[model samples]
Target: PIEVVGLLNDLYTLYDAILRNYDVYKVETIGDTYMVASGLPQRNGSRHAAEIAYMALDILSSVGDFRVRHAPSVPIHIRIGLHSGPCMAGAVGVTRYCLFGDTVNTASRMESTGLPYRIHMSRSTVQALLSLDEGYKIDVRGQTELKGKDVEETYWLVGKAGFPRPLPTPLHIKPV
Candidate 1:
């Protein structure tokens, strides 16, 4: 299982680097899935949405350069999703901090229904990004059915606004 271990190491490294630069907090990481959040335990208002959106894009760009130790020829791809709303956060059991509410569930649904190597976001997140004036580009994904939540409009975070179209080709490593 060296491949799995190596992949996890690479991913953790990437996440660690991102955490150092953003105000977001790591919610959890189960297997290859990672969950992070902002505006919790400290409430920074709409800035959380912008932080998450930027972090998601940075993650995608990093993954583009990541290669599997066992399968170096293949590029690693990640699907990220985000939602902006209120949620309750508190310690669960003995030491685990957990998030509860429809917002969390909706965010999970966004990831579950999203495409690989893309960032899917709820309309609330999009609006937050706009309000923050972070210069992010988004493409409407139209109405999508979400579990437990009725149909909702979603969008794909394309990149920073006013940047070159088609975005730069994601960095890649040559097959070993």
Candidate 2:
């Protein structure tokens, strides 16, 4: 059996650290499966998806590197999926507020079906980010048929560190 206690501690610590610098919706761990999300509670316009993408990329990269350096015997990698859409968030119980919506399902699937260390995003999310600022560089990975949604154009987030491509130039995103 896996070290459930150790894994939970690690997940909680990592999740808390990521949230300190970026937005974090929630962190849920069942057995060894850990799921995290950003851009909920409050949407900062279009930065939601991009922010989540950045966090996911950094977290995966860090965890992968850590495993490689300290625990080379164990090949550790995590898959991430991100999608943006309308969702209702509120505090239903007296104890704490919980969020629910179709976007959650889509995001979960994106992560589940996604390749390790990759950020799978829906076309709608890409458009949302673009609408806010076309500065983020992205490449199209072709359209995908998500679990719930009929279909969606998918793209991999390359990086935002570089300047945006010229308007006339076309963008091409690849699977990472």
Candidate 3:
């Protein structure tokens, strides 16, 4: 049976509040797959990418804490991805012009494979975010083959809104 549309009014109300405040790009809603982005239609070099990633992480952390304190019955997790590169931005179709480019594709892939409550980024985006004034807890997840590219490195946004520099990689490695 078709569900009532107004059931998620509160959900969408809060969701819209987030998208509007952040540098949200296009949001495609398919069922529960919420895809959003930044650093498009108005690129700010590389800083925009980092800022967006930071905001995403912040939002996730806040939501988690809020749920624990208020709604213990409902827990929500967010997965985000970010990438920075030269993408061909253009308007296609006369009636409905839309953006298209390799950068966008890569970003989507990053989101798809991202872990819940985590922000994944391409090597370029990681480097860009590292250069920002804010401190971060980033982890170098090594290189991974991103879609539509020969090879791409990946990083995970570990933490923000605290810390002075990214903490040392927490790994247990022994001689091979």
Candidate 4:
């Protein structure tokens, strides 16, 4: 229905702006699946991981105000997954841009295993964040199975240094 389209548009619109602030890139949004990336096209060093992490937190918190035109009372939830690694990206057929690699696949797994209203991340992503700063709050999610990959540890991104934890986000994700 048109209402669903409106909901998707509204969510994307909000997320896109927040991503821009963090210098993250919105690769595409297929239905409700929105894909994003950083440190690509032009490299930003390891900070790409941090940028994506902060952007994900921002977008997830924004969901608190997001309303579906069809159901304003229904709360919206989003699951964000982050993996830091290499990938091949470029505009493909029909000029549609794409990122292809196991990195993308593993990132997808992080999201699939993630719960609503949370930002799930791989250990690699955590390492990248720690490399840049020690102030990002993270919670251990323990080992999770990824398709084509053995069981691996994962985590939830709670908050970042110097930034107010997202408000009314239930968990209110604060630093530990």
Per-residue accuracy of model 1 over 40-141 as CA lDDT, tens digit each: 767886689988887787777777777777889987767788998988899988868889899989899999888777788999999989887868888998
For each of the candidates, the C-alpha root-mean-square deviation to the true structure, in angstroms, is: 5.0, 6.1, 6.0, 3.8
Clashes of each: 0, 5, 0, 0
TM-score of each: 0.87, 0.75, 0.68, 0.90
Instruction: Please give, for residues 1-176, the per-residue lDDT of candidate 3 as tens digits.
Output: 12223424444455666667677665455555555556666766656766577666655655554333244576555567777777665666664335467877888878766766667788777777778857766787666666566656688888775633332322333212
Local error of candidate 3 at 162, Å?
A: 3.7
TM-score-superior candidate, 1 or 2: 1
Each model's lDDT: 0.82, 0.63, 0.63, 0.83
> What lDDT does candidate 3 reach at residue 123?
79
Per-residue alpha-carbon lDDT of model 4 for 16-94, expressed as tens digits? 7787788677787878899988887678988898889878877776787788878989988677889999999988798
Q: Which stretches of candidate 3 lie over 4 Å from their true place?
A: 1-12, 65-74, 91-97, 145-151, 163-176
Q: What residue pairs clash in candidate 1, if any at all?
A: none
Model 4 stretches with alpha carbons more than 4 Å out: 93-95, 165-176
CA lDDT for candidate 1: 0.82
- Give the Cα-based TM-score of candidate 1 against the true structure: 0.87
Candidate 2 lDDT (Cα, 0 to 1)? 0.63
Ranking by lDDT: 4, 1, 2, 3
Q: Mind giving the per-residue lDDT tens digits that candidate 2 earns over 151-176?
A: 66788665565532321112243434
Better of 2 and 3 by lDDT: 2
